[model samples]
Target: MRLVIAKCSVDYVGRLKAHLPLAVRLLLVKADGSVLVHSDGGSYKPLNWMSPPATLRIVSPDDVELEDGVISQWIVKSTKADEQLIINIYEELHESSHDLGVDPGLIKDGVEADLQRLLAEQIELLGVGFTLIRREYFTAIGPVDILARDSAGATVAIELKRRGDIDGVEQLTRYLELLNRDPLLAPVRGIFAAQQIKPQAKTLANDRGIECKTLDYDAMRGVDDSASRLF
Candidate 1:
């Protein structure tokens, strides 16, 4: 990774046009040819960025550019799309490169998968008499987060997310549609479970006759503590 703090102006052109006036900002260039322009604030989100599968070209300013006091110009062009980002650097405050070798990739801890596993162990949370059949129930599209049976012996196909958005609801709907096709699992119902569910997602799930569940992860973990000690 290469990091640069520079007095620069940025221009983006593609589906929409945007401009960042001259200021000292952070420029991150990743090994994958992705470039991110960031301000000091805004959490992890960048001010502007060109995703991977892009190319970066840096060159000294030309006569016209030099006349305007531009020292260097960097152009990042997307290979996958029609997007382009241009940065005109008048002065560089700092620059450094780090040789961090290949990453092992993210190891998530308390994400949706963990939530699904916890919910499967505590199936009764779904309702009294509820029992888990299995986790990652297989389907043609993908694995359903959890497959369980309700109190009345009805099949329940659940989709889990850390934050329930409309997309998560749509995913559960697809799984339910596919699962309902199987003769034995026919008439399968869906439950969209998450730690936090968006209002729009809840509305959509309710409209589709699918139940929305907000899980208390810490409470569920507390329930699991005793079980873990037994092993």
Candidate 2:
């Protein structure tokens, strides 16, 4: 991963458009062909990011851009969509690269881990014809808790939390945004599953068109228990 700290401005072009004024910020260019722009804060979420399968290219500033003091331009284009993130570098503060080998991936623990396993096995709990694709479905940002196909066969991305809150909803939103960019899952929907979902989180999830599901930990575990065996 290449990490660059620089004074830059950003513009996103595609279905939706946005702009970030020039400021000193962190730029992450990952080996996966993804680029993320982050400010000094805002927790772990990047201000703007381009998820892989994508490509990054650096070009000298044009005369007009150069006159404005832009030293270089980084263009990140998504291979699967019409989206691109353009970063105008005005000054380089620091830069470094790290070799992060194949990741072993995050390990879920406690009840949350059990929930994911149970849900995958009893996917019908989601709906009559729902079928689980897999647990911890890989994405550039992170692994989706579960990936499934709904009754009609549309792709579904799920984010599981022990206690569903606004943060979980936001996380799921990011996953859906990235997942839907892939042609194979262009219309992926989302579900926020947890043992207890807060009112605020439920409201936010509903506002974002993400369905919310309450998990029954004990019931699910009970279903997993072995039935009586004949002597």
Candidate 3:
């Protein structure tokens, strides 16, 4: 799957329109260990200022796994909604392959972990940091696909898409809310990186301070290299 990282809301909206019927879920994860899922035809009506948690999973932390189709969809979704979020930290390690200064095998290991090692390596060279936080609730809502953090410790959320969904911002808004309330997290910031976003929804993000960005997965393999160098 390809990925594109855009810088603004307008682009995201346009791309979303070009894609539709996105067979994905919208997930909401809380810092207190709560998980919620909102897949197609799932009810998402908020009650008393909050939505209730859907089916909860009982799985070990280190034993994280996903079925194949879901994983593909997740990779696409995460690449769009949260570029920095899904990228694993190991991808940022710097090592030279040919001179044996760095083991090529190690780089391969990073990839096996689903870390964008090259992207991580480049971003670190540019002085940025990233870590992936797996939240079960997001998987329930739909799938977070990707969640990222910058060097200064800001959150950048991405939702990957092969087609557009109308609830992109709404889904991201929930994640943002959860992130902002976390005491252990650095100051939270959010961006909805989508193949597209709804028009009025863009206005809502603007009115509320959330940034909406667009991605062109077909044009890029992963997150943009610019964010690492735009000093």
Give each model a TM-score: 0.55, 0.89, 0.39
Cα lDDT for residue 179, model 2?
A: 84
Could you give candidate 2's per-residue lDDT for residues 11-106 as a string of tens digits? 999888999998999999988888989998988888999888898888885534453788998889999889899899999999999999988889
Kindly report which residue stretches of model 3 are placed more than 4 angstroms away from their true locations once superposed.
1-143, 163-166, 222-231
RMSD of each: 11.9, 3.7, 19.0
Q: Is candidate 1 or candidate 3 better by lDDT?
A: 1
Best by lDDT: 2
Best-first order by TM-score: 2, 1, 3
Over the stretch 81-150, how does candidate 3's per-residue lDDT look in tens digits? Answer: 2211121111111212222243233222322223233323333322246554432224323444455666
**Could you tell me the lDDT of residue 14 within candidate 1?**
76
| lDDT digits (tens) for residues 56-151 of candidate 1 | 988785534443778999989988668789999999999999989976643445667679778988899989999999987755355788999999
lDDT of each: 0.83, 0.90, 0.39
Error of 1 at 217 (Å): 9.9
Task: Give the distance in Å from residue 62's predicted Cα in candidate 1 to where it truly belongs.
Answer: 4.4
How close to the true structure is residue 173 of candidate 2, measured as C-alpha lDDT? 95
Model 3 residue 201 CA deviation (Å) reads 3.0
Evaluate model 2: give its lDDT: 0.90
